[model samples]
Structures are given as C-alpha cells and as structure tokens.
Target: MSGLDETLLDDTEATVRVRFVVNGRKVACEVAPRETLVDCLRNELELTGTHAGCEMGACGACLVQLDGRAVHSCLMYAVQADGARIDTIEGLTESGVIADLQAEFHRRNALQCGFCTPGMLVNAHELLSQVAEPNREEIRDALSGNYCRCTGYEAIVDAIDAVAKARCEGGGAT
Candidate 1:
C-alpha cells in the first residue's frame, strides 16, 4: 500500500493491541480503537473499580491515575493509553497508598452508596500528594468534579481534611 493507503488502513483497523501497566502489573489487550479506557478496564480486564458515569468528563466517577495524574477514564481512549501507566482504585488499595484516606473516609462517613467512593479516593489521593495540609475549602475544591448523591459533601470534605491534617502532622501512614 502507498503511504496514504497505509495511513487509512491503520486508522480503519477494527481493533488495536494496547500494552500498558495497570495498577503495577503489565497487561495487554486487543480493544476497539474507539473503546474508552473505562470500558477496556471494566469489560476486558474486569477491573470494575473505575465506575462509568456521565462519560463526558463531567462526572469524576471514572477517575483513575494516568501516569501519576488523575484523569477521567471515560474520556480517554484505550489506544491512546498504550504504553502509559494506569492506576485504578484497586491498584491504590493494593499499594496501601490510600489506606489512611480510605480509613478516614469510612470513619468520617464520606460515602454512602459507594458509587463515587473510588473516584473520590482517586481525586483525594492527588490532592493529598500536592498539598500535605489542605484546608476544608481546598478539599472541597479538589473534589468538586466528583458528585455524590448520598453524602452532602460535608463528610467527604471532613474525611479528606482529616487525612491531610494527620499526614501533615507526621502521624499518618505516609
């Protein structure tokens, strides 16, 4: 095929093989070019911790760490994430990086239905990394994108704030 034909051929391929590190383990998948990362994780890998909501980047329920940064999995294509490091909620739990935050979230009643907990934890994980001692306002701002229908945002804010305070004081699991 000529150069233009090859380009079109690559674009029209039904599925692309993507290889990446998920949660710390390397995984490879053959996914449709149009499949979103969340779909790949949920459908192909059976990693269901990343919820599907809004699917347009508005709701943060599908948040995951892409290359150490929080991103909406629903908004990212699986092929686009090839060769990248992806960390789902399960990975964070296995690593124990979010143990303290999870404990605080439970203690402070941060989640009720638990649908948004994973995304909330993912975003909270990012915030705690950037700011060791975030105030209530800062915590609220960090979690603004995640929506919780059960909790009124107060408990979630308290949980994140408590964890931030404990970490800043050097008593946290950091």
Candidate 2:
C-alpha cells in the first residue's frame, strides 16, 4: 500500500486519547473514537460495575454518575467524557451512602437476580441526593429509566422510603 493509503488506514483505526476522573482517580487512555463510555469503563479502566444492557439506552443497566448526574454509559461516547468526573457502581458505596441503601435493600429484599441492583442503587443514590425526602411517586419517577425484571419495585420503593424516613427523622436530611 502507498504511504497515503497507510495513513488513511491508520487514521481510520486510530485510538483517541480520553482523559477523565473516574471514582476520584485521574485516568487517561487511548480508545476507539466510536467506543462508548461503558466499553471504556469495562475494557480500559476495568470498572466492570457499569453493566451493558439494552445498549440503546432504553435499559438503565449501564447507569453511571457523570459530573454528579446519573447517565447511561452506553449512550455516551468515551471521548465525550474527557475532562469529566465519572462514578461507576464502585464509587457509589465508598462514601457510605450506598452502603446504607444496600443495607436497606437487603432489609427489604429489594434485589433478586442482582443484575439490576447496581443501576437501581446508583439511581436511588441520585434521587436521594437531590431530594432527601422523596415520596413514593417521586421515587418511582426517579427510577423510571431503570428496568427491574425481578422484585416488582414495591420492595425497592419501600427501601428507599424507609431510608428517606430515617434520614428525615435522624436530621440527615438537608
């Protein structure tokens, strides 16, 4: 092949460098321009907690907190995360917020298959962060994007409501 053709080929196959802060750690890596955030997290950063289901963003299984907001990893390009703060499921529990929620989930038997647990936890965390005392309707609205094939959502709502009630009574609500 000619030099020009080789250059074109390289350009087509070139991996772009993406820089971002994941779970409070700086990360810089080369990834295909077309790669999604889920791929980068799982394959490059090795943060497998971000699941890939219904890659079209319909299923909230790939939920992650980007710049303090919950987003579907499969819907975002890895390059778009440059200079962003990313938090996968691994980061959710480190601050003890998710731990409390997890305890509540266990107490409520909110999880069954566990595939949707991470996304549910992250979404719940986001909801609680924004509204410390969200009602059942609000909690359901917050989790509208997430799909739970098991557990039927009653227990999940109960868990969240209990946590909210506890926080309100404990003066943890702001």
Candidate 3:
C-alpha cells in the first residue's frame, strides 16, 4: 500500500479510548480522533453542564478545568486529554468549590439565559484561585473571552468582586 493509502486507513480506524478522572470519578470512553472534549464530556460521559457554543476556541462556553487549569474543551480533542484530570461545572458544583460564586451570581442576578453560566463560573473559579483579590477591571479582563448574550457584564463583575471581598473577609458571601 502507498503512504497515502496508509494515511487514509489510519483516518478510518475505530474510535480511540480516552481516560480521565472526572469529578473524582474515573471515566473511559471511546472517541473518534476528531471528537472534541466537549462532545466527549457531554455526549459520551453525560455531563451536560459544559455547553458547546460557537464550537470554537473564541467562545468560553465549553470551558473546563483540564489538569487544574481552565481550557477550551471545544478546541481540545478527547485524545489530547488522555489520562488527564477533567473538571466540568458539574464536578466543581458537586465539590462545593464554587458555592460562593454560585451564591454571588444568584444574589447579584449575574446570569440571565444560563447558557454561559457554566463557563463563566468555571473561569471565575480559576481566576479567583489565581488572584484572590482582583479588582473589577481585572475581573472584566479575565472574562473578556467568555461571552454572555443576556445581562450586561456589570452584574457579573459585581458578583465576582463581591465574592472576592467575601472570601478575603472569610464571610464566603457579600
């Protein structure tokens, strides 16, 4: 067989097995070489909290923590995350890692349509973990990638700022 034929054969091969520790649970699934991590998480693993918006890296709707860092799930192939630790909104919620953020979002009415909430919360969690006390401008800068079509970002920024203050004061809420 020619080299091109070999390449074609490889492309037509069966699904590849990918493994990850998701939400403190071990998960393994077979995915096509082209299957994105968002598809794997939502379709294969049945974790739908991670939304797929724009299907590109520009939108942060498919954000998930990969190996302790937020990443665009829609841009990463499942095979690329093999044997990695993945955390979707479901995982973070279950772990109570973002409870304060969730509460602040609710109190501030930061979320509107709920489509971008998961990604926003995930990114906020990541930002807070990195910078305990980020100003409003810094918060906005961090959320520049995530797009929310519902409410103006004022409430979101307010919520994050409130959370930051609460956390610093050890109150956990504003």
Candidate 4:
C-alpha cells in the first residue's frame, strides 16, 4: 500500500464528550466522531419522539430546536451540539405549547399513523414562537420541510391557522 494510504488507515478515531441542555435538562454523553444528534437523542437519551425517517435530512422526522432554531437532528453531529440548548418534541409539552399544537392537530385531524406529528409539532411550535399570527402562506412555508403522507396538509394548515388565530385573540389554543 502507498505511504499515504497506510497513514490514512492509521488515523485514530476519537470519542467526543458532548455536554448540552436537552429537553430542559443538562446532559452529557460520549459520542463517536460521526454520531448524529438524532442517534444520541433516540439511542442514548431514549427520546424517541425525534424519529428517523429518511436519515438524509429530507423527511424532517428528526427535527428539533437547536438554540431556538428548527434544525434537522439527522443532519447534525452530536459533538456539534456541545454547549448548545436543544429542545425535542418531548420538551414542548412541559410548556404547554406543544400540547396545544397536539390538541389542535387532533381537532383538525392533522395526523394519521402518527409518525410525522412530532416533527410537525416542533416545526410549528418554532414558527409560532417567532410569528404568533402567521398567515396561511407563512404557515405553509414553515411546515414545508416536514412531510406527512397521512394528511394532505390541508388539515395541518388548518390546525396551524387555528392556533395562530387563538393566540392572536388573547386565547390559549388548548
């Protein structure tokens, strides 16, 4: 083998210790160099709400809020989350924001099979946090990343619009 090939084979694999705030709790975990954030959330922390669909960052099933921004967990390395604040779907109910969304989803029949609800809720929550009264276009744009095969998006849009209207009218969604 060439010297360069030999050196490449000898390269060491490092285990990184990452510390981050997840789901309102501080957590520390040792992860491999290539371990994705979704793996840590589901495998290590057992937070299964963050699903893995495409594993290519396309389905948005692994969506989570990283530092208050909606990010695809499958697209991020666990080590990259070190010292960052991460919020999964599980964290949403603690504040009732997600619960409200979930309730609205149910009322509007926005979910079926239940696989995409978590990601959808996380994305919707992030949108509502920034724009409490987003219009139909804005809601559609915000949820464009998430894919739900069960609902044709009409119900989902209705659910989001209902939430926005409730929030704007000085009323709680749930």
**How many clashes (backbone N, Cα, C below 3 Å) per candidate?**
0, 0, 0, 0
Q: How well is each residue in 8-46 modelled by candidate 1, as lDDT tens digits? A: 475665788999999999999999888999999999999
Q: Give the least accurate 10-residue stretch of model 3, judged by summed lDDT.
A: 1-10
Worst 10 residues of 1 by lDDT: 1-10
**RMSD of each candidate relative to the true structure:** 2.4, 4.4, 2.9, 4.4
lDDT of 3 at 46: 93
Q: Which of the two, 3 or 4, has more TM-score?
A: 3
Question: Candidate 2, clashing residue pairs?
Answer: none
Q: Cα miss at 60, model 3 (Å)?
A: 0.5
Between 1 and 4, whose lDDT is larger? 1
In terms of TM-score, the best-performing candidate is 3
Taking the tens digit of each residue's C-alpha lDDT, what string does model 4 give over 1-174? 445545534534657689999978999998886889999999989999899999998888899999999999999899889999999988876777677778899987999898999899988988898997999999999888899998899999999999889888888665
TM-score of 3: 0.94
Candidate 1 residue pairs in backbone clash: none
TM-score-better candidate, 2 vs 3: 3
User: Where does model 1 exceed 4 Å of error?
Assistant: 1-13
Give the local distance difference test score of model 2.
0.88
1 or 4, greater by TM-score: 1
1 against 3, candidate with superior TM-score? 3
lDDT of 3 by residue, 46-152 (tens): 99999999998887999999999999999989999999999999999999999999999999999989999999999999999999999999999999999999998
Give the 10-residue window scoring lowest on summed lDDT in candidate 2: 1-10
